[model samples]
Target chain A: MNIAVVGLGIIGGSFCKAIKKYTDHRVIGINRTKSTAEKALKEGAIDEIGTHESLENADLIILSMYPQAVVDYVSRYGEYIKKGAVVTDVSGIKRAICPQMTELSEKFGFVFAGSHPMAGKETNGFDVSDADLYKNASYIIVPCNAGDSVVNMLSDFAKSIGFGTVKITTPEEHDRMIAFTSQLPHVLACSYVLSPCCPNHKGFSAGSYRDVSRVANINSTLWSELFLENKDPLISELDILIENITKIKDAIKAEDTDALKALLEKGREVKQALGE
Target chain B: MNIAVVGLGIIGGSFCKAIKKYTDHRVIGINRTKSTAEKALKEGAIDEIGTHESLENADLIILSMYPQAVVDYVSRYGEYIKKGAVVTDVSGIKRAICPQMTELSEKFGFVFAGSHPMAGKETNGFDVSDADLYKNASYIIVPCNAGDSVVNMLSDFAKSIGFGTVKITTPEEHDRMIAFTSQLPHVLACSYVLSPCCPNHKGFSAGSYRDVSRVANINSTLWSELFLENKDPLISELDILIENITKIKDAIKAEDTDALKALLEKGREVKQALGE
Candidate 1:
């Protein structure tokens, strides 16, 4: 199988490397910056640096870019993509991107499936990409009008490349869950670090501070785009988080030990039930 | 030197193991549950299971217990402790504990200084205690009227047991800083995990989810006491956090991309400046 991976950032570069490392699939790397593709080629992660013409030969096309970029790329190069080829994306948000790609795929005679690999590092770009980035990570697939055979192939491919679980769900469900699990945590981390006391946390902090503030070192531009694109769901999650925090604040302010203990116990119970 | 570690829970047990592994000090382990001290002695983490009488021979007495338990033990056994012995504690909150311990030290002739080791795991108990738990971790000391000699000795002892940095400050400053750096994160994590969406977060979660919810599997009884003890400072920090989260929530609700981007950029800048 010939796999064309567009956008040689960390996610794209990692997919290329994982495919090359784990299977006999020929990987063609494409990127806005030719240097990244060239670097991946030199590292033997990809068979070649790809042109738009390479789309015609690809059995699978993975768009590993931002939501807007993924939409634009498919629109611009849809005609060149081979009929029956399965096109998937590794974007964080999917509700807006999947429908647009599905419509474009219909016009171009290709299959569109929206995918999100639930794994990443703090750093970005091809230099930090790893073949094991997807190891033991969850993979979500939104079958946006794609046939069952294509979805099954993508699920098998995800497993082969070290994904421990592959969940098939609608784009709406994916966005809703991502809002709570991914985007809200990023927002919480960002907000948590903006406190006046953050600068003086050197000797005062431990695991909790590290865990809460870890995602604050974010790709601001990319995240801002993601936040705005999934505005309603993200806002809803943020409101609930803020409200929940307020309850704790009120309990602490009133010096209500029982109320505070109850809240903390509830949280522990919820987490305990998850058995993570 | 004789080292008496009272309260053989995770922190106390770890202290015993670390001292045994890294130094030649005779360790006497004491606990409300005598079985725990016996286990520590049998495991070679301590030279003996300590009695209250063992306090007479100690050069350093470590109260590795809850804040109130530390005060109660010191008050109950103040007469037994060797004169001029430096006594310290590993409590989360310092403002409340330090003054009481300081007054008791004056009455008992033992020098008192409060200390908090900035290290922990989600799980507790002597069974999970690790010898290297303090390796490269921060240690904060509240010099509650202790002399320079005692402070220096405590600092040297901390370093010998694998602490990378020893920060000396007032009880007020320690409580204020810890409210933001330590306590607030726990509150945030607890509140974050209480969301209805947490149970279904299996395939939808990744590093951010794992990090944010890591501390939610807490010892609720222990944390409730710590939170109420440092009520004022923790409440102030929680208010600030809620306000900061509100700003992000407002921007997303208004669909103001530029404002959202700027807020995210500020968080990134703050985290990057920390250089962690």
Candidate 2:
């Protein structure tokens, strides 16, 4: 199989490396910056540097760019993509991208499935990409209009490249869950670190501080775009988080030990139930 | 030196194991549960089970129980502790324990210094305690009228137990910093998992979710006591966090991308400055 990976950033470069390391698939790397594609080629992460003409030969096309960039890339290169080819994306949010990609796939006679690999590092770019980035991570497949065969193909491919699980859901469900699990945590981390006390946390901190503030070192430009694109869901999650925090704060302020204990116990129960 | 560790929970048990692994001190284990002390002795983590009579021969006494328990124990056994012995605690909160321990030291003639080991796992109990639990973790010392020599002795002891750094500060400063670094993160994590969406986060979550919610699996009873004991400082930190989250929420709700970007950028800057 010939796999064309567009945008040689962290996600794309990692996908290229994983495919090269795990399977016989020929990977063609494409990037806005030719240097990143050249670097991946030099490292043997990809078989060749891809041009728009290469889309006609690709069995699978993975778009690994920002949310809007994924949509825009498909629109600009739709005509060049071969019929029956599978096209997927590694976007964090899907509501805005899935529907449009489905429409474009129908028009172009290709298969469009929105995928999000639930894994990442704090750093970005091809420099830090790893073949094991997707190892034991969940791979979410939002079958926009793609059939069962397309979904299964993507799932099998993900598993071959070390994904532990493949979850099938709709784009709406994906956005809603991502809002709580991903975007909201980022917001909390960012806000948690903005406190006046953050600068002085050197000697006094431990695991709790490290965990809460770990995601605060973020890609601000990319995240701001994602936050605005999924505005309603992200905002809703943020409001709930803020309200929940206020309840705990109020309990502490009133010195209501019972109330505070109950709240903490509830959280512990929820976490224990997850059995992670 | 003769060392008496008056508790056999996670912290106390770990201290015993660390001392046995890294030093030649004779460790005496004490616990409300006699079985736990026997187990520590059987495991060779401690040399003997401690009694009130044993306290008189000890050169160092470590109170590794809850904040109030530490106070109550010192008050109950102050007369038995040997003169010139260095006494310390491993409680999370300091403001409430430090001054009380200092006065008890004056009355009993044993040197008292409040200490907090800045490392822990989500699980507890002696069974899970490890000798290297303090490896590369911070050890905070609140010098509650203990002179430089006593402070130095405690600092050296912590380093011998694998602590990477020893931080010395006043009880008030320790409490203020801990409110933000440790207590507030627990509050945030607890409140975060309380969301209606947590149970459904199995496949939808990744590192951000795991990091932010990790501490939610807390010892509720222990944390509630710590939170209430350091109520003012924790509440102040919580309020600031709430306000900061609100500002970000307002920007996202208003679709003010520039404002959202700037807020995220500030968080990134702070995290980068920490260089962790």
Candidate 3:
């Protein structure tokens, strides 16, 4: 397969390297910055570097930019994609992106399968990309159509890149899960780092403090856009977490030690059972 | 100095083993169960094994029992402590035990200082104890009287056990810091594990998921008791965390991407600045 990878940064660069390692796919790197595309080719992330004009002949197109850029890219260049070419993405949120991607694919006569590889680093760019970036990670596949031949292709692509589990879900399900598992945890970690108590004992921390706040040290600009774009589901997840936390507060206020113990015990049990 | 360690659990066993490894302090291990103390001795954790009755003439006594049992041990055997013996505890919380310990020390004619080593494993007991567990970890000293001779002794002891930093703070400061930095993080991690998305995607988790939730699989009974004992400080820390989190939520709702980004950026900065 001839693969055209747009936005040759961390995700795109890593995808190209991984595809070459696992399959016979020949990757053509495309980036807004000519220097980045040249770097990707020099790093062997892609078999060749190409302009946006190469979109017309590719068998598969992978969008690896941020969410808003994705919208712009599809709107402008998506119409030039080859008919029946499978289009996919590596965006974190699926619900908002899937519909628009599906719309563009229909208009351009291609197949759209939305994906989210649960692999990322605090650092960004092609310089940090690696072929094994997605090893043992989760890959959520949100096919626009269940019966599309491209669904299997997308699944195989995900497996080839070292994803341990490939889950098939709706766009809404993907969004909700991402909000709960990723967005809320990052928000909580950042907030915990900003708390006054954290500042008070900065000198006394160990691995626990570092581990809890590692993700909080992410690129703020990218995360802010992600939080804004996925606001609805993020808000929903935050509400639920806050509500559960309030129960802890109320139990404390009532001086119900037993109730408090029960709450913490339940939390511990639930967390432990996840490992099962 | 002769060192007597009461309660041959992970903390006490590790203390004995570390003392034996790094110092000439003759460690006498005491446990409610004879087998545990024998195991500690056979494993070379201590110079000798003893019953509670043998705590009589030790120059330094380290109380390494559960928080609840510490007070009981003090009340039951406070008089058995030799005159001018410096007593210290390895308890997590300090405020709850400080006043009573002071009074008990005054009546018994011994100096009581509190110490908390910021190192532990997920598993408990002497079976998992190691001499080097405290290497490079923080050791917090909570002394009621700043200039007391026992404070110097405890500081030297903490250093002798391979602790990199010996931080001096009041009992109240210690309790509040533990609540914010340690207790609150544990609570959040356990709650994140309990979320529906976590359980649903248990099979699809990456290293990030395991890294964030590793502490969630803690011992519930002990943690619940700890939380219940430090309810006030934990709740206060939780409120502060909640306020910051709610700010993130409002930013998401308003689509104030810049504000959200700034918060995350600050969090990253603060987290990175710690322990530097």
Candidate 4:
């Protein structure tokens, strides 16, 4: 397969390198910034670094840009992609971009599906990108009218790069699931980090404290955008998490050890079931 | 100092190894079960394995028993401990035990201060003990009676085991701090793990999920005792955590991006301030 990756940042650069390492597919990278594209190619992330014009004949096209850029770019350049070629993305929130992607695919006679690889680092960008980033990670695949052939191709492409793809029911489901799994937790971590007693009382941090706050030091601008984009579902999940914690707090307040134990036991069971 | 660790469980065994590795002290292992005591000795966790009689000659006595066991064993054996010997502990909670420890010390001709080395693993017992457990971990030192030679000796012992010790103002302060930093987080993790969606979802589990749930698969029996013992402060911290989480949840439900952003920012600032 000939793969064209737009946006040569952390996810895109890593995808390019992974394709080169794990498959016979030839990867071409297209970044809005020429320097980043050049760096990706020079770092062996891709077989070639090219301008957007080079996207014309690719077997697969991936929009690895920010959620907003992906929506804008796919809408504008959907026609440049080859007819019947598989097109997907690495956006965080699927619902926000999936509709635009579907419309773009339909208008351009191409196949568009949205994908979210559940992997990243606190520090990002091309410099920290590696081929092994998705070695054991999940990639949520949301296909809407992209056709069965295109979905299969995208799934094959994702599997070839070492991802366990979950065929999500809809973009809404994908977004909501991720809201619970990723977004809410990040929000919680960030809040815990900024709490008054933390950085100020440096001497008191333990392993749990460190682990809970590991993702606190994040790219605030990017995260802020994501939180805004996926606001609806993320909020719902946050509410559920808060409700669960509130139940625990009330039980603790009553000194109800039995209730607290039951709550903790439930969590343990859930985590064990998830095999986490 | 000649130190006697009066329990050969996970923490005690690891303590013995860490002290031996970093200090010149003579380490003694005491356990109700003779075979376990012998095992700790044979494993080099102790220079000697003996009875409560060993406490008579020791310059320092490290109480490495369970939370409830500490009060019980100390109350009965308080008569055997040596004059002017410094007594300390490695229990998870401080407030519940420190007052009793102070009272016991007064009657036994010894000084009782408390400490908690913030390092451990999910697995228990002597078999999994390692001397490097405390390296790079914070050790919270709670000294009693306005601090004295005993406090200095306890601090030295904590430092000897590769920990940076911080002096806690009082037992209540120590308990409240740990409840937030340690206990509440554990409850959250345990709850997340027990949630239905998490069970059998390992393939979708990322570093974030793993980070949060790593400590969930803990020894629940031991945790139950700790929770019950430190019920007061644990309950207080649980309320704060619940409130924080619930506040975020409400913002999410109302689709309030500003509120969500503020909460996320709070966590991020707290974590980053810790220099993680």
How big is the positional error of residue A43 in model 4, measured in Å on the Cα after superposition?
A: 2.4
The residue-by-residue lDDT of candidate 3 on A1-276, one tens digit each, is: 899999877888889989988888899999989898888888778888887789987998999988878878989987788988888888888777877887887787888888788888766888888899988787888887535567777888789878888888888877777787677778987898887877666546676666677687677877787778788888988988888777877877787778767777777777667553
Q: Score the docking of each candidate (DockQ).
A: 0.85, 0.88, 0.55, 0.50
Put the candidates in lDDT order, highest first: 2, 1, 3, 4
Give the TM-score (0 to 1) of chain B in model 2: 0.98
Clashing residue pairs found in predicted model 3: none
- Top candidate, metric lDDT: 2
Per-residue lDDT tens digits of candidate 3, residues B19-103? 9999988999989899998888888888898766777869989999878788889888988898788888888898888888888
The clash count for each model shown is 0, 0, 0, 28
How much is B198 displaced in model 3, in angstroms? 3.6
Best by DockQ: 2
Docking class of predicted structure 2: high
- As for lDDT, the candidate ahead, 2 or 3, is 2
- lDDT per residue (tens digit) for residues A1-276 in model 2: 999999988899999999999999999998989888899999999999998889999999999999999888889989999999999999999998988898999999999999999999888999999999999999999998889999999999999999999999988899999999999989988998988889999988988999899889999999999999899998888888888888888888889999989999999999999995
Q: Lowest summed-lDDT stretch of 10 residues in model 3 chain B?
A: B202-211
- Candidate 2 chain B minimal-lDDT segment of 10 residues: B235-244
Write candidate 1's Cα lDDT for A67-129 as tens digits: 998889889989999999999999889888987898999999999999999999888999999
Cα deviation at A36, candidate 1, in Å, is 1.2
